[model samples]
Target: MSHISTINPATETTLETYTLMSMQAATDKVEACHDAFLKWRLKTHDERANYLKRIADGLRDRAEDIALLMTKETGKLLQDGKMEVELCAQILEYTAKNGPSILADEERAHSAGSKKGWVTYSPIGVIYSIQPWNFPLYQPIRVLASNLMAGNGVILKHASICTGSGLLLQEICNDAGLPENLFQVLVIDHDISDKIIEHERVRAVTMTGSDTAGRHIGHVAAKALKKTVLELGSNDAFLVLEDADIELAVKTCVEGRLFNNGETCVSAKRFVITDKVYDAFKEAFVKQMQAIKMGSPENEETQLGPLSSKDQFETVSEQVSKSVEAGAKLLCGGNPTDQTGYYYPATVLENCLPGTPAYDDEIFGPVASLIRAKDDEDAMRIANDSRYGLGGGIFSQDEDKAFRLARDHFDTGMVRINSFGAADPNMPFGGVKDSGYGREHGGFGMKEFVNAKAIYLP
Candidate 1:
């Protein structure tokens, strides 16, 4: 049997290793989870909500340990990991408190007469969730919490680097009184994962990762006629308008770009600043980027941590190098010191052009792309000029104008007007174009893998 090793990026050491399960064993897990779903679906929404509440409590009780593990495995800051745990717990509680009302039957009128009709949401079977290591626990929980509330079983195939986090999450759910096999983790490789998508017992699939990987999973599932929900990568833009408060925009943009060590899909990456404030924003932004402390994720004072792995570090470094070669100017913090571990300091690139990685693709690290816009109109135009549309931000002192732009003109799935975005339970998540489709959070996720049946009554 082959083995998977979980690495600590901060130390470049192996924390633990596990043997990958054989195909037969993995198939058995899918079957078992589907069996659990059969019985689970018969329970009322309130019963499911009670179980969800228990799971939320369990997450809180174990937040410290879980957050520490995340820091070791993924190199995200310990504080961010803790906040992620809280966000995950909140997602569970939100689903529990609001799911019954969201999924309750709705009355309608029959087409032929004034007779009453109703629609019911019935749970499907198993959901195969493929998640990335960046948000580890939070990534899978978003899918798991809602699907369990909708009465569906969930099988997880987390990123190979975060296998430990995946197992821990599954254990937490079962320990919190969720029935056996209702949620399972598959510790196999991609080969088996593809076959599992075609598994008869697996009814749907959901994934959060880069668009390249998301495309492959989505294709395999589509071939088997399975539904897919993918939350892919983005080169999200943050606009600094002419009327923007310079310091506010600078502070918020720095926080947005560097959060999660700059590995977030929706974090500000492209800085589209109007020419009027371009010089001021660049000067302040460069100073802030340079001042950020890059060191151990365990240090509370360390403002930036290493990339998730050596491979991630190499990728970000290479992208920056290529962008510089393509005529982008390195404003500050582009050099790598002799630091141990996979550390890459905060870097900024300006005059980022159309064809370079900085302007075109998601860098997935602490590198910012600065683009000078002619004016506010040009800033909005440039923000929309990407293949990705997951999320974007607008900074303007004119609150009404920013809101209007976000509401009517920002071509992304979600937007922030004069602020930054972290996924919220009360709002919908996911994106458009190459960022992939399908919505989570709010009440939409609970219904994604369910059958909405319309019934006509006498």
Candidate 2:
């Protein structure tokens, strides 16, 4: 076993070291998981449910320690990390409560004199889940819990920055009495990810990462004839109509953009406001942006944490500078502080034009670009102009108009009317267009890792 060192992205500090599974080791683990699945899948639904429940209990029991570890590893606020731990437990419990039923066989009547038809859900062998660092625990657990409960062994390739969280998950599973290798975490270098994905024992791949990475993984999986589910990056739009509640819209916008220090893939990247309320919305939005507290994530009072890494901080900072050079006006917080960590204040940019870099790009930091819309038509046009159609929101007082805009105009997988785009355990979450394909939560998420087989008997 090779040793892997964990480094804190914030302070470039060494946190801990653990033995990592090599490519050969990961391949062996996948084969072991495949062999284990023969008996694991044969187990009764009640048994599977018990295992999931135990995993949830373990997560809940160690929530504090896990949360702190996640904070140190990913630089998220401790409170947010704690909430993520709780959410991960809830997801596992939800899967335990719902997975068996969702996978229950369905019977259907066939044509006259034909064989009866039926559909059943079955595990798709070993599934490779490539997760991001943003939601270290929640993202991986969301897939792991459901896949494991469905009797599919999972192979996780978590971001290098969050390896500690990944190991913690494996520990939780072990404590829950899950078989070794059933939910293996591969610690191989990033270069070897594609080789593991191509392994014969791996039947499918699920990834949540950059669009470029998604496309690359998607291509390899497609060539191998393997099923894939991808949750790519997004440049989501938050449209506020003329009749929208200005105060409410502004508050939600702030919360949406600044949430996770604006590191979320679903965070609203573009703000399209109607002329009627543009001034008011911009004023309130900028004021709230300025008021956000940015410091050490360990501090309970810190509203915004450092960017996950120096690369991210520099990326967003450069985008802000280039946007200003292209005539976009910086209302607040465009400069990076001289602080120790990668801390840039919540930024607001206005008068953004089409040719600017920030106009079409996804700014993955506490930077909000304001685009003025002449009316609802312009708002829709601006929202749909992007290549990305992930999660988007429309703020409008008129119910009919909001519904119409969301249903007819918005080009996204998940749309929110009168609310910023959010996800829940019960809702299906994914996106359209360049945002990549496939859903990741609720019943839809469970199906991503399984194979739906139809049976007919004559």
Writing each residue's lDDT as its tens digit, candidate 1 over 1-458 gives 49989999989999999999999999999999988999999999999999999999999999999999999999999999999999999999999999999999898889676799999999989999999999998999999989988999999999989988999998888899899999999999899999999999999999999999999999999999999999999999999999999999999999999999999999999999999999999999999999999899999999999999988999999999999999999988879887779999899999999999999999999999999999999999999999999999999999999999999899999998878877999999999999999999999899899999999998
What's the lDDT for candidate 1?
A: 0.94
Query: CA lDDT of each candidate?
Result: 0.94, 0.86
- The global Cα lDDT (0 to 1) of model 2 is 0.86
Candidate 1 Cα outliers beyond 4 Å, as residue runs? none
Residue 381 C-alpha lDDT in model 2: 95
- Poorly placed runs, candidate 2 (over 4 Å): 1-4, 18-20
Per-residue accuracy of model 2 over 160-230 as CA lDDT, tens digit each: 78898998899989999998778888888766788888889899999998888999999999989899998
lDDT of 1 at 191: 92
Q: Relative to the unseen true structure, what is the C-alpha lDDT of residue 285 in candidate 1, on a scale of 0 to 100?
A: 98
